[model samples]
Target: MYHSILDTSVEFIKGVGPTKADVLKKDLGLFTFRDMLAHYPFRYIDRTKFYKINQINPDSQYIQIIGRVISKKVIGDKRVKRIIAVFKDETGIMELVWFQSLKWVDTNIQVGVAYVAFGKPNLFNGTFSISHPEMELYQNRHLGRGNLTLQPVYNSTEKLKKFNLDSKGIQKLIAGLLDQVIPQVTEDLPQYILDKYQLPDKRTALLNIHFPKNQQDLNAAERRLKFEELFYIQLQLLHNKQLRQLKFKGASFELVGEKVNRFYKEFLPFELTNAQKRVVKEIRIDTQRGVQMNRLVQGDVGSGKTAVALMSMLLANDNGYQACMMAPTEILARQHYASIISLVSDDLVKVAILTGNTKKKERNILHEQLENGEIDILIGTHALIEDKVQFKNLGLVVIDEQHRFGVEQRAKLWRKNVIPPHILVMTATPIPRTLAMTLYGDLDVSVIDELPAGRKPIETRHLYEGQRLRMFGFMKQEIAKGRQVYIVYPLIKESEKLDLLHLEAGIEQLSYQFPRPDYQMSIVHGQMPNADKQFEMQQFIEGKSHIMVATTVIEVGVNVPNASVMVIENAERFGLSQLHQLRGRVGRGAEQSFCILMSGNKLSKEGRIRLETMVKTNNGFEISEIDLQLRGPGDITGTQQSGVLELKLADLASDQIILSEARNTVIALFEDDPQLDKPENSMLKAYLQKLQRGISFDKIS
Candidate 1:
């Protein structure tokens, strides 16, 4: 359980000098022997299997061919120049073409020399050819036949290839590093744990990973390494949760007093859904236990999350503590402030809104009221974390769309009070179960799985551009029923590369169709001034306009219950979550609502699936699961910035079993030896410490 000699600089390796070392560090983030070791290959080549030239097809993927070069020639003029070599095996002959570095290939390659070539094949005019295949002189091919089972292929960049550092070059460097450093590596796992898991020792696993003796050894190496990686991640999360709970004594709210009772009895806007009541009860229990509550409230749109949050805030208010809510956008903050004000108008509790748009005089009054405990609840955007804003006794913090804030920004709010406040982050974007397990593992989760009664599911349909005239008839029918409409465009201006509909052109055509005297249209986009955007949104909310033609800026906070139809232009351009959110904008009122997804006839496979999923169901969780499958774990929105889901081997979507097992093991270990002070747990502690040095867990935890 000591530091690795692999921590030595990459430049010290025999094959990597200062120049190549710098390029490796900048391009691949490889600077030390350990870095190189952890840079696992994307795939492996079966060197033992060689394909004949005659057996190769155009669709063949990276086949290894044993052949001899018969002739070499340069073809075409200077502009279309290429080096073509006729290579023949015993079965047949094929062509190897290189469009780049023709001079080097034509001069260095010799005819009638036996060689081994490897690359993907392409077909043109009934002949198979390979472009830029890796070639090596074949000598003593049978000397180490059994050893040529698998060849590791590292990923490389075009820049690295210019310096002669392709996959083969990187493989050579790694081989040299392994020979020099593998002897010094020691086992990090305890003997008992290793025996129980049937995992190999660290030295053996490292060697086998880079150069496996057989398929069995490779499987063992992969399992051992994946376990180590996932184990440390779970350990850090679980350990941090334990430490936080043990150290921080949360403010206690023992009684549900005046504010909660009065709101329920007199000023209740609507009967609380059973789901909302359950979620509030969960929050109430957390607040009264004198333990910090870090909870995630996940619910789909129109699912009463705001009602749950308001009730929780009232719980804090009844205990003589102030509550604050932060949203990702100013408009969302204002919307929350307006709704809460309407709900609590008769109640004695005070509420206020703060954002970048607050004037100097209004800001001063609001600031003074917050310090004097006059404002029981304050909702704002990023302005809530500013230094000038101080609360009398901030107890609970609710963040909507919490992923929009960075780790540091959230940390600033956490440090606002002497004792960190209980945090409740709400998300309308329904997270798939496996993703939630990995991303929000440390927090307690409560899901409001049901929408309030009397809310109708939005009817969604997919339409092609050729059916626009019929779609316009549907829009006019909805408008004639005294309901407003929302037409959302993916782009504000047209782009030459993309043929999708644009907002300006859409509005102009719509204006012509429904004429200005009879129909009023409001336009908004991100590029507009905040004041102008606000004005346009206000028009839609107040029913001053019959239709709002704009971009996705209205996707989140503009709640117009009267709007019964939502038409998304080029719906194929949006992600699954975004399409769901936009659909959520309607279906807020008692009237039947419809969402029309307009797209071109030609659609990619994923695009077709997305539109069809929207048409299939309104369930956010189901859509998220399909999204995880189509987009992958890394490409999901908000995952890239968190750094929590940067999994190298374990797929979040598919490896739930492994993730759960790893989490259970960490929890069991901590339950037995809370501080890892036992002799048997020392190796685990040492390994965890080493892993922590490479990753910054503090901010994330």
Candidate 2:
């Protein structure tokens, strides 16, 4: 019954008839009373203060003045027409101008009449004026009047403004609707929750949000609404998780057999970091359990994620089940294949690679081998999920850079085996704890926080254009030491808008700096043919090229341990994550590596912060927190795809404490009533059903 009241059409509201209703829907997506309630104000104005005309200055942001209109006149004609009025208080006189609705403004004005005006103050010709000020008769500005209280400033489009539906108009319409709906707004939360959280009832919250009696009321209303929003999201996620665990059965791998032992004993490339060992054990426990394992392994760049993934894959093979890995790009897939081949050289594991570039005959052979279980581990791009490539007893799947694949693509891979395979998703881009809780909250997360032993942190320095000669000398010295260099440009072609260096021009400049016969050079960019790109990358990896000039295409999958120097030209143009990934390309070997960020002398505040963050620490999680601040949650690569991040008032960026509290409360609630079968939780169950009907979060699984 309460929901029905809120779901009534806006056209049924007293002031908003059919015409205004259509405009509101077309302009702001407000179809019902519920929509209007959700459309919270972006700002509020204090209407109690009135400034004298003498206090108006050029620096004033927005001011309210009480004065009488001494004179009025129409100035200019047609397109440039405006109505000007001279308003005077006892202190001084100020000009009030209206550029829009000139005829309406001119007809409504009277000489020697008092009015209260509000607007931003503008100074021209050594005089102060208020242009397009919101004016009202001074008699209506007394205490207890509407204009004497705090006013909500809502967001509206110009199309709505055409029908007198700007912020003020919307507020008036909301006032009319509240009169009818506020009485019917019932509490959605159980009585215990309201008491425990010290939250106001639903009707009070709705009333105060649209028309707060005081600052305390506004803050309380905001807190109650934010908590409710975040709480429901947590409830839905945990509920889905519980259902998934109860419904889906997993294949049990009860053996730690030949293949894993062989790789651990002889084919191991380096001593396993304790972090890596812990993560591998976690995967082992998950696989052995009779439930499907969906885990996210997060680590910094070059933190041995692939090593852990390979060890887990070997565990699957030991139990008579084949494993497959999927990557976003062909290059990463091939790189993974090469790394796996090298790791298992002394072992008896069969590994195969399939990608778009693979020969048709070779692919046919691979298809046959894979179906017959001849391939123990297969690494490929999207080709791994093709209908023809079937696995005999697929047990585990590892997705590299998991955010690059959409939900549908991952779903296709999960459906390959009758009972879906154990899933391990990996990412080098570290996600903050709050984001991980909301974005991948359902999956069990494991972090390899520490880097491996014997690896030195990359030395990063910020350099400017004036230091070009010194940078060149340093590059020459590194090349003299038989180490390679990577010079990355932000763009492939010159952009007129951004004054950053491009890859083609960067290559030419480097060629001139170190001429042929002395320094070997290679170039790579996105526009190059795949064969050409592979050839140049392979040349750099083989140590045949001393300097490689490229774009951010090398930000991933290219692992050259011997490349001891990364020179990022115009590095300020890149995001913190991209810059960090590019820097990760180096520092893979024993010797100390350097990342020299080249930028112009002048930098924006954000650009300086990003560069400073790169110079401060090598902690990916810390960098990610700052990145989340600079670029909001929606702008981050993976967070937007998870529909949960589209929060209205509860900020994942700022409200971490509230979010944690909400999650804990929801967890405790479910402990007592798992299915929400109690009468008190019926409202919560209905709310959850509404959220489920609107969102399809199946992608997270």
Candidate 3:
């Protein structure tokens, strides 16, 4: 019977029964024939040869043996049956044992029967033995010229196995499916391109991927799949970019005012870095061209991205247009409002702050003022996107810490304006260029590579717990000079059951060491309510609290320039990028800053490397790249839902050369066939359809 490939009936698959199908569908989200085809193997096992009994070491757990059953006996009771047998090969004799499977031995083995067994070898009572080894009957037809060949092991759910469907059974079903599908699988790639890349045919790749004859075949199959995945993704991103630039037209603001020039001449704190100037110029050019700007501004922590964003907003304000900056949190919003208000004269520019906590009466006033164009600059969190709030002429939308906002949230902001205000997304996390090209290929990228003048580089040092007293003494000396300090911990609550009780215990210890009576101290964590947390943070900012003890909640928004010293407990537990972010909380002002990383003695090699990288340089990009290499791309971006690129087969750090080549290939293809509608581009179209199954195809158009 023929079945629809996309049908949701799991039982229709060859080996999946009702109960087993439920387990596969519920546990793995595999409910269709297409899902099974896409569920690739995690690894392959080689079962080509058998080793002699004498050649096996006692510690060897995975081995194959060819032997004959010399003797058999049952040792345990009926409730707990144990069967043991002795087998002899050309080299020596070994014991084979099974637990709770007496019937299996009786039906499968006899005194003179020869079989092949595979399992881990163990030593019991000075005899080499294997327990519950997987066995197959030996015959002249089954035995190759010598032994069995390579085997494929699949990942399986325990629930499915209870219904008599396991990894081996799934493997058999996939093999059968591939056999039937191979003949129908026509080539979906251009012959010239395939030849240039030396990729195997689609049918050969599928067959070899499922059941490879040798390592070379497996390698060839892997290359074909990885290249195909990346190529299609690149094609989609480039096409989307072309459509956006061609179809959308943005409102352009004329440079007709001296407000920005006056602000730059009279109120500017310091000179703009070369990187910042270059990026601001790019934004100006985009705005003057009357095209919607979808640009990404990326930089390391304290690399002056915010300054460049402010300059862009100034450009919009000079042309009688309103600008809005959306931060991820209320604290960051308030901080930006304060900083920008100080730089620009309050009389010329009316800046307003709107957060979730703003009073209803006050919010109503701000709403009216914003819609009437009385407020030229507005800063807030997600609350700014509420329907009640409106902008008279929103020319530019600057999203700080862009990763914190979701795609839907950003879309809401876009819908607020008639022309979809020009977007400028900023992030402190330094993404490597290769990953940026693959993930954000649809947006123009502007990077700020320089820091402002008189900004001292944070001096980082790694220390063990044994040096705690010395570190404490240093902290005391620094605090004596009237400089504030920040002591950060990983966890908020104290847990007696956890081995790492550093955060809570350290708080208590510091309270005693600094003597809270002498120096005002406060603590903040995520568990605290927003009001209470803000109160404590205000106390620190107002100089009422000389020392603030907190978790990573204070990592992003809190800007305390006076807090020159940062102490991170259990620093090794954090990724390198996280450690750098925590370090960035300080050193924002003219005062020199220091970051002390306290790690335990039992540090792994990777953990040691992370700590050392933090100490060696304050360069966020360099540390981020190293962190990506050591911990991998997943952890560098935080969770899977962080909108960071999730490549199945590509490693951003290791595959740099391949990524560059793929990008160049994509640009060239689009240059020749912009819509990919040429007869020669049919293969590319089919390949993209197969890769991005459920995503909307209109994104390309």
Candidate 4:
């Protein structure tokens, strides 16, 4: 078998032997020439400007200087060991330091030798020193504005630093390997694509990406690389989508009959929002086509996603098929079961609820009913995915807060029916359009952007610790109005590392303020036993308690219509997605609701932005876009689980336009040549086939 030149091991590269290559592999996951070339810089520093020691200040930017080393000394013990070299220019003297590669630096630098030094200057005591300076011998090198102006900075670990493989070291290795690899890089994109998008060739993009002379070239490089990365990802995703259609013979609920109509007219909790109606239509279109329905339903809190899901299940029931909805937690399962039960007539469709908390006798009866086809709809947590829990004629499977469940867990439900059941995964956490495109690109997406009628937006506010008294008074006033409240903390118990408000302390303080019988309280957290937690939650649900003190367990929970106030303690500690989800717990009822984000005065810039973003808008999609920007692609909700966004250069937050164009182009290409059998797209077809087999495209794509 032939291999690409990029497959050449990094150990074979010049200046990087076996020992250094092993270190590189361990420290930065760089094992081959391809990985090295793909390691793009996070940022760049201009090395054009030159400065003298006398021209430096504490606040000066990264500067380059030419100086001769007069003296060098090793200082401090083993842990704090560092090399301090004094360099003198025509004007004055400045300190050059190396704390990482001490021995290497000590051996390399010669006393009274002229060298070019570049690094950010920092003031230690009274002297300005450049730590871990990039140094090269000054022989006949140009003194003013050298040709290599923009220098790339790659990420490196502390261990890499010890091996002299810092950002500077990695860049040096890449600089040497680029020439050998550039010619090997091939153009995988079709000529039409290249011409239409005006994308540069593969070689030009890779060349300029690592070592661009100017910003314009860098932008062009990024544009092309980002397009290729996203293009291949979408191509693979679309291929899978096409294969899924070809593979699975799905349950076709052709009859939109009695149950679906009756439920829509008489039992829907509220009038169907246009978004929900449109989604139902989409589901109908998908199921009628005889292909498996793998659709993602993204909606904000109280946006009637559950209603849409229930309606879809009714379509299943009407077609003589059993439907099941799975939730992440028992509370959520029971909540879904109750809502679903209320939506459909007991005589029309039998509904059963089973959970981990269900008694053995009850579970046995439930399992028997499920297998016997007596139960038309079964709702539960992970317990529903058990081997014994068989569905008679299960057709529609709705997974709520789907991220909480694993891939295998979802697959088990698919295996329940011989023909893989129609799958509808739902989440109230609205994913950004770009993120949704990448994460659920294979699955058709239906978003419920509008909330139901008569529902008011939850007014959110940020409060500091000093305003506790005022917040307490406001809580009391709300309680006086016969409305319930929720106080959520970051920690269940005192955490030594984090200065967060523990639920224990929070409840204790609240008890003193609200006082005994006048204000009854219920506490729920993850640490509590199943029965105890459920009991507390039920107490709050039944309006037996005025306040519910808990951790984030309340985030995905049963809705309490009377609960109008949600106070999130240490709000800065929560991500934007989490903050939004927690705030969603309230504002489910007709009455006005409030989400008071309580935090310390000292908040990081990102933390402050999160709270402000929450206060600024109730739009989950907007919050998701900002969240994607703040957290990047990996950390945003469920993208990590999908593993599709393990992109080298494309950022889901910033590269929406590129992703859309690439996806559309791939889609158009597929429409023309579904099998990519066209002679015009031969290279592109071959590249995708290799990608499907887990081959790295290297810089080709």
lDDT of each: 0.86, 0.85, 0.78, 0.87
Structural RMSD, model 3? 4.8
Ranking by TM-score: 4, 1, 2, 3
Find the number of clashing residue pairs for candidate 1. 0
Q: What's the TM-score of each model vs. the native? A: 0.93, 0.90, 0.86, 0.94
Clashing pairs in 4: none
lDDT score, residue 425, model 2? 96
lDDT of 3 by residue, 134-184 (tens): 676766425422232556656776565555455566776677656555465
Error of 2 at 221 (Å): 1.2
**Span of 10 residues, lowest total lDDT, candidate 4:** 140-149
CA shift at 45, candidate 3, in angstroms?
2.1
User: Which window of ten consecutive residues has the lowest lDDT sum in model 1?
Assistant: 692-701
Between prediction 1 and prediction 4, the one with superior lDDT is 4
Candidate 1 displacement at residue 68 in angstroms: 3.7
lDDT of 2: 0.85
**Which one is best on lDDT?**
4
- Give the distance in Å from residue 476's predicted Cα in candidate 1 to where it truly belongs: 1.7
Candidate 2 lDDT over 1-701, as tens digits, reads: 23566777889888788999998888888888888887788766777777887777678887789899999998897878898999999999889998886655777778888988888998889878989887768886653324426677789876776677777778778887777777777787688888998999877887777778677899898888888878878888888777777877878889999888888998897999999999999999999888889999999999999999999998889988899999988889989988889888634799999898989999999999988989999999999888888989899999999889988889898898998899999999888888888888888999999887878999999999999999999999999999999999988888999888788787778889999989998898888999999999999989898998998888889988899999999999889988888999999999999999999999999999999999998888999899988987767664467678887677887888888988898899889999899998987787767666883321000
- Tens digits of per-residue lDDT for model 1, 1-701: 55546667789888788998899999998887778888787777888888988888767888989899999999999999999999998898889999887766776678989988888999889888889988767884443323657877888876687777888788878888777777777776667767878888888887888788778888898888777767767887787778789988788989899899998998887899888888998999999888888999999998989888999999999898999999999989999998888888735689999999999999999999999999999999999999999999999999999988988888788777887889999999898887887678788899989988899999999999999999999989988999999999999888999997898899778988889789889889999999999999999899999999989998899889999999999999999989999999999999999999999999999999999999999999999998888887666656567567777666767776667777778888899899899998887786566565773321100
Please give the RMSD to the true structure for each candidate, in Å.
3.0, 3.9, 4.8, 2.7
RMSD of 1: 3.0
Model 1: pairs clashing at backbone N, Cα or C within 3 Å: none
